[model samples]
Target: MAAKAFQPRHQSVSRGIAFRLVSVGCYSVMAALLKLASEHGVVAGEMLFYRAIFALPVVLVWALRSGGVRALTTRRPWAHLGRCALGIAAILCSFQALIMLPLATATTVGFTAPIFATVLSVLFLGERAGNHHWLAVALGLVGVAIIMLPGGPANDTAPLPGVAVALLAALGTASVVTVVRQLRHSEHVAAIVFWFFASSALVGGILLLYVGKQHDLQTLAILAGAGFAAGIMQITLTESLHATQVSILAPLDYLQIVGALALGWLVFSELPGQSAILGGCLIISSGIYLIWREYRPQTIARRNLEANTV
Candidate 1:
């Protein structure tokens, strides 16, 4: 009976890992497509508009499939709005960084989101950080500093503006994560996902009036692919979280850096400098350790028990 029971859990975990890998792959491809679109003269705002617009149908379909239209309904409209706003900012900054910086550099810097999230949680969520957490955060920041050091091996004419924007994106992402943590208390996942696309579409549409530019067929195709990939990434990530403990999924997020590096080399003929590689290693190590600490066996057991009860 014990072995039989364990089999299903093992299968679920395997499926979750697969889904998370697919999610990371999708996001990497989407970033590459967005970068291609930018090369063809598509501005960030237009890309955002198309991405959000094309993603809406997918999000809606998913929401309906999950629980009909009622699943999209939410009492926390303002919270959704705030989440969307921050998300849009993060997207815009990230898109700009994708165009302006090398893929590896941009991705390495953006990986600092978790570090920023930890600090923000302490400040805003009134969460107490233990010594281990602080050490992890400090190490992660050091990693970021190494990557950002001017004229470092990784600094191959990487524009200061692009680096700054990438950091801003990381900060925005951290903020969004913090907000979503709060929203989970009262909002459904479907509602949060739906509102984000809707609000992004609205915001992107308005911004298009000023920053939009003409695109050829190739650029249009790339934009559409980016949008589709974004939608798939979001859905797969959600499904992965549902199937496995977040701690199990968190480390998999680092797989994105591998994907980013591979895509960068294959598509853009770009390579990361020594600094970037070293810093990326640090960031990944710190993040994995932090996640390990946060989700130790006891904590996982408690969470599992609570989840079962709920």
Candidate 2:
């Protein structure tokens, strides 16, 4: 294993914003196409195989270009395994939610990860949370409830199962974040990425034996695009963080919801109800506040201490 190499922050907020914006687009497209594939009869487990396997070559090429093969080596294999496992579970949940719910609704629910992350820090990192943190978490839950609540018409649709799974996805995502943050201190970005896709593809390949089904050419193309978009999103997302504070970029993430809304309407003929809109607003506000709080000077100091202790 190689020691971590140091690089200075890019310090260009404009470039960071651009990367974040692109990342948001890729993520939106990934989720949208993922849902489209599901409508074509692809299951989440099968899509997970496509998402991981197709992204492997892309990640590998990028890893080689950015650094030699050595950049793919890691000091902590177990951490990478754990992160990959969490990622697979989180993505499966997200895909399941997308299949069961509308695009905008699923995207909005996914944003609740920050709320989960806040609680994770307090519980596992020995960070003391103020009342505001709990308030933010409560707001996030209220938003989810509003989204899941039945409204108007004959009530033919029930989204409770999807919303519940989406919340679990958010928790899985937060746990992955904690492990990845720790890994970044000592592992190269390329290493963290390479092993993730590599290991996930391996696991997904095995699971494919039970869940895999053939797709039409059109559906295969959609899954391939989704995989590429996911890979690009991962790369650009990491670069964005290297350039600026996550708090500054956090608000821009809501742009994905707007994108999701457009895709849901234009592609799937789905429109979010008033409750979904209101709930989305609450979830976004909660996520933004949680991210902002995490970046505060006082909080960052405590976080640093927590990291050191770990």
Candidate 3:
């Protein structure tokens, strides 16, 4: 009887694990395709255009299934606009970084988003922080330094501009996370997601006019595939959250570095440098510590509330 009672939760956790794995794979595929597309003369702007336009149908279906027409409506237009704008910029920066650096290097650098989010929460949300916050931030910087400093992993290996762009992308991504926290108070999740896709498509369309050109059929197919992968990544990622606590699933995200390293090696003959490995370790450790610090209080408070109710 006790075993039966635990089955449902076990199933939910299993689903979370499955969905998270698929989400990671989809993201890796998208990144690889984007990188490949770039190699074929596809500009970052054009890739954005295709990715946004193609991802629309998938996002729309998910939105409708979740909330119907109501999901498309939002009371916070300005907030959505801000999120979409930031997302677009971050995505473009990521694409550009992929062009300039090896996949593993870019992936490792991109992991700084959580650290950035922590800082943003302290600055904008006025969230109080303790020693862990400083330690986490410091570790993050050190990891970046190892990758960017002379004789470090990137030591004249990858372009300096690429590293800078990747860091900016991480900051932009963190800003999006901060904005989403505010939006969650007044907006529907479905609305927030749907509108972002719509906005991306719109922005991509405008950019397309300026940078679009004819491409080989193979390149076009890859771009389309990248867009589909992005939507699938979003869908699976959402499902994973619905099934389990995000903190439970987020640590698995580091697996992406491994996949990126493998893919980059297989496809482009790119190898992970010593700095990349060492720096990635520091950043990852800091990120996990931050996640633990962020969640521990909530877990404790919930337990306290449950005990009080009993």
lDDT of each: 0.84, 0.84, 0.84
Clashing pairs in 3: none
Residue 267 alpha-carbon offset, candidate 1, angstroms: 0.8
Q: In model 1, which regions exceed 4 Å deviation?
A: 1-11, 299-310
lDDT of 3: 0.84
Q: Write the per-residue lDDT of candidate 3 for residues 1-310, one digit (tens) a residue.
A: 0111101233377799899999999888899899999899998789788988888899889878966787677787888889999999998898889888888889889999999999998899867678878889999999988888777655755677889999999999999999987787677677777788888888888988998889989999999999999998988887787777666788888888888988999998988778878888999898888888876767558656866887
lDDT of 1 by residue, 1-310 (tens): 0111111233378888888999999999998888878888888889789999888889889878866777777787898888998999998999999989998788878888888888998899766678988999899888878887788987773667887899999999999999988787677788888889988899899999999877788888888899999999998888887677778888988888898899999999998888888888998888888789767897567656866887
The 10-residue segment of model 1 with minimum total lDDT is 1-10
Q: Write the per-residue lDDT of candidate 2 for residues 217-250, one digit (tens) a residue.
A: 9999999999999899887887787788777887
By TM-score, the best candidate is 2
- Worst ten in a row by lDDT for model 2: 150-159
Error of 3 at 186 (Å): 2.0
> What TM-score does prediction 2 earn?
0.93
Clash count for candidate 1 is: 0
